[model samples]
Target: MLLPNSKRILLKLSGEVLMGEQQFGINQETVAELAREVKAAKDTGLEICLVIGGGNIFRGMAGAAKGMDRAQADYMGMLATVMNALAMQNALENLGVHTRVQSAIQMDAVCEPVIRRRAERHMEKGRIVIFAAGVGAPYFTTDSGAALRAAEMQCGALLKGTSVDGVYDSDPKKNPDAKRFDTVTYDKVLADNLKVMDASAVALCRDNEIPIVVFSIREKGNLARVLAGEGVQTIVQGNK
Candidate 1:
């Protein structure tokens, strides 16, 4: 499915992708390559916002499963996202791309607070804004944070760059015969539990009428191709 004309977009990336082939944590080479791909897309004149998950460093749910307080674990996960955001910001700046890191949780030393107008101005000045901290609350995934920011920023679409090329009926890795959908409706995704994203994230996009384009960011040059409506992806939107 081809993406619609989008002047601004929010790119939601799984933090695990930042790990490259490592067991955990960010890989410098992988981050650099991803930055280049983002730079290529930016050169096309599209305003970009980024939200990277913290699964690579810490996963709140995983911690909670081990008997940790859910809220405390989630807060730790949020901080991890800030670290990832900083790494990405550094990489983008190294490539001569102006970038900003806005955290939902305020940290005067490292980044700016989430100010909607300020973020808009940064984008107006050709700066990519990376939002961190997952809505400044517990039990919320970065996916939900991405959706909230996309709606608030009035982004044309939310581009989810993940390991998989598109949403499938089942786990493609485990189920060899899993069916990949070119286009799927939000309602179906929620009903069947397709896992395109967390339920809250999907519902937010549905309510705001923002298209979610899921594609493989691991594939070099795929981000640009998807932005150009030429890559393999699944477009999740309101029913046609």
Candidate 2:
């Protein structure tokens, strides 16, 4: 089955997903499993794009506590995303998924620079374009960068694959009584202070009319299920 009303989707996966059960670093098995799910989604005829976070390897804010400059740490974090992107590229290609890694910052020897037209061409050709490096700047999370890319790529929706199934009234793990929403309006998310994405990212999605599908990546094949509207997820889009 196809993702109803969606021809293209931008998937935002955190670096931690690549780490599997490990404390840090890429886990080969996890990446392979994720690639399979992505391939399934692709098989549904959706042109896919990826925007991966770098928290598994490094978080600029965390590095700053270790006496590293914020910009320096952020640059390091950006590089970490590229590493994750490279790992994903390898995994997807191994499965014959046909993938390309495009970094926001130009590093031609390592990967292609973020070129809008070229990226669009890749997607049209059914190649998964993995976007990395977080806007190629500091003081911004990959969430915002992902939103930007989703808008630029003209994707139908932004699928945020996280550890939790959906946006909750409170931290679900911390509060057993927390309520989960099947869907939420942009205003409700901001007014209720829901932890979907950062303010800038959420705002970008709202302004661009791009729906954000928040679902757990930990569940086996949940990404494909969510797209088919058969999995637990929260859709943050328009209206109250």
Candidate 3:
């Protein structure tokens, strides 16, 4: 229940969350559930912006490892993000939540190009703006995009919904002794390799002084709880 501020927020969702019980692609039922959560959150009157990753369908680095050119692979990854945005837009609209997909790579055929002021206007009008594509460039994960979008929109914090409840000293899945942290300094996370996020993402957020909340998105109401400071999660903050 300890928010740094009551300003608008940017939510970063991994594409793997959309996979649900499937091995790949999207699961509409799960997406609907997520949309309902967003609807509830939006009902709280907090302006929200979204940035989703394309890992479910593909990751540029994964493709490049298989022989595709790095730039071409990254563009492919960007396209994957657009697909997710459209899917999310559909689910949100079905729930009566007006949403828009804005991509960094001008894709008018599918969605609007990312226009800062336009996205701001959308938020003002109570619409959720979902940002897609990986900064329209290669070699960067969506984490960087999320940080950039959060900064560009002046969001209070970056909510990174993940499978784990919070950041740990090591991979909890592999290391059962990896201690979960409720609060940590940004430098500590990077120095100790806590995997709070990628180095680039963490560096950008630390530079911008944004708190990163890492929590479980599958815990039903955890997002709301974390926003209220009642959830099990890690809070990575800038050092004094």
Q: Pick the lDDT winner.
A: 1
lDDT for each residue of candidate 1 in 1-240, tens digit (9 for 90 to 100): 255568899999999999999999999999999999999999988999999999999999999999999999999999999999999999999999999999999997999999999999999999999999999999899999999999999999999999999999999999999999999999999999999999999999999999999999999999988988899999999988
Which lDDT tens digits does candidate 2 get at residues 135-185?
998988899999999999999899999999999999999999999999899
lDDT preference between candidates 1 and 2, better one: 1
Question: What does each candidate score in C-alpha RMSD?
Answer: 1.0, 1.2, 1.1
Q: Which regions of candidate 3 deviate over 4 angstroms?
A: none
Clashing pairs in 2: none
TM-scores for candidates 1 onward, in order: 0.98, 0.97, 0.97
- Cα shift from native, residue 91, model 2 (Å): 0.2
Candidate 3 per-residue lDDT over residues 69-130, each given as its tens digit: 99899999999999999999999999889998999999788899999999999999999999
lDDT values for all models: 0.96, 0.93, 0.89
Residue-pair clashes per candidate: 0, 0, 2
